[model samples]
Target: MARSGNEQVSYRRAPNFLTANEPEKRLDIRLSYKSFRALEEQALTLYGISPVEYSATDSRVTIYTAPTALHGYSAVNLQQAISFAVYNILVQHQKQELFERIVAVGESTYSSVNDQGRRSTKTPDAGLSYYYDGGTVLTIIMEVGASEGYTHLNADILLWMNEFHCRTAILFYNKECPKFKFPGNADTYSINDRPALEHTWFGTLDTAVLEVFKRDQNTDTCKMVVQGGSLDIGLTIGDVLPPNEDAIQDIRGERVHLRINFVRNMLASGSHDTAVSRFNHFIGED
Candidate 1:
């Protein structure tokens, strides 16, 4: 209800399928980006604070608040899934030019002008960039929603596309239930303690819907790239690569994919193969 910075956001959001939290930071407060940037360094290096994002247009700095260790698992897997695919493509081609042009910028902050022409800064869970003449030309930003619903997360996807001029964004909409109470500073929430309810992205990361978005294409629309369970198919090699004409076409395009089954395992269910802890299943389902 109160104004913080220049914008006041709602405490709730709607669900969208094509996508896509840390935690909901209490609102009605303001902090300068410069101050945040200073804290961000110490927070990241010393406290392990991560997946923090905010725009200079506003004073609200968001932390992908970890409700459980599962959030961290989901974040890491999503980042590696894309990073490895892009890295493998570069390695297979073994092109020196490609290596120099493409930079693997994993979980880094972005400083750019906002749609309103004000300078803004934010960070993605993971990303890669294509450089020409020493500056980024094309960028791929990956965002995973855990404690948030569609509207909040999709807005992020659009920010990269509309304001940052970023292309090829990936979204993972987690299907974990959110009925459990958020574990406050007093204690750490565990996945087993998470309520077993209907699948929803309101505040958890279970299995997820994988999708891709292109900046040049309709900003509001996205195509599903992968799903969960045995039906899952990993994303194509070209899907992760830059869409620019100069980018790799990959003669083995259809032949290669970033195996969704492998990458999504840790997010899908409890397993010693990926990790020991995971969210419980639905009330009636297996």
Candidate 2:
């Protein structure tokens, strides 16, 4: 019996003709295990730490500092640790709360028109969103690293803020990077009836400042007000940057995974209260 080498393998088009022929456009996006795991690996490898730094509890993942690494833990690391921990907690709670998955986007899903009616898309560094059955809603976006001149950055945040009507953006900075210094921390500045950018700082570089983005379209203004710093910014930012090949090698020692079980458990455990708390937490009202 002779079998054609290529014929042996059967190739057929997608089962659904409508969806198969449809143009591939970005819609309500979701995360694949590959994408999520890659990001976690990237984060750990880029940050000059081992994944082992994260310790998983029943419903939370706690991050610990590597014993040999100097520079002490920084706010950046602390924020990352908390985020990772909560991520796992959320995962475990997904079934109960209907929070199926979490995702990260490379850009913001928004567009705008100028006074002349010219349209343009708004983008962010990296976005984190939670997925439900019907669709996906943005949960958080991490603007990986930024230098000075973040004034325009507020506009992008404004677009997201207006769309979701929620806050909670996390921005990270390299320890040696230059950033604006406000006279005080978490001060709100207003412009044209909307919030303008606020100023904040960490003790050193590699800080992650959680900002609340507020936009007032009626007044045509956007503001990003700083909230607080995390625990491990110093250690990560100071040592890890431009994450070179050597840096990745140093980070391969351990694997750090987010334990979002607790957060998810809480969400799944209840509804009215959990929903309210989540919405409030996103807006920083709670």
Clashing residue pairs, backbone N/CA/C < 3 A, model 1: 20-173, 21-146, 22-64, 22-65, 23-65
lDDT of candidate 1 over 42-159, digit per residue (tens):
4343433343432211212222222334445656666665555556666777743565565667667677865688777767766666666556754677776653466556777887
Q: How far does residue 103 in candidate 2 sit from its true spot (Å)? A: 1.8
29, model 2: CA deviation in Å?
Answer: 30
RMSD score of candidate 2 (Å):
25.3
Against the true structure, whose lDDT is highest?
A: 1
lDDT digits (tens) for residues 187-238 of candidate 2:
2322232223232221224433434332322423222232232222212210
- Candidate 1 TM-score, true structure as reference: 0.55
The residue ranges of model 1 lying beyond 4 angstroms of the native Cα positions read 1-68, 89-101, 114-117, 182-207, 220-256, 268-286
- Please give the distance, in angstroms, between residue 76's alpha carbon in candidate 1 and its true position after superposition: 2.7
lDDT of 1: 0.48
- Per-model lDDT: 0.48, 0.32
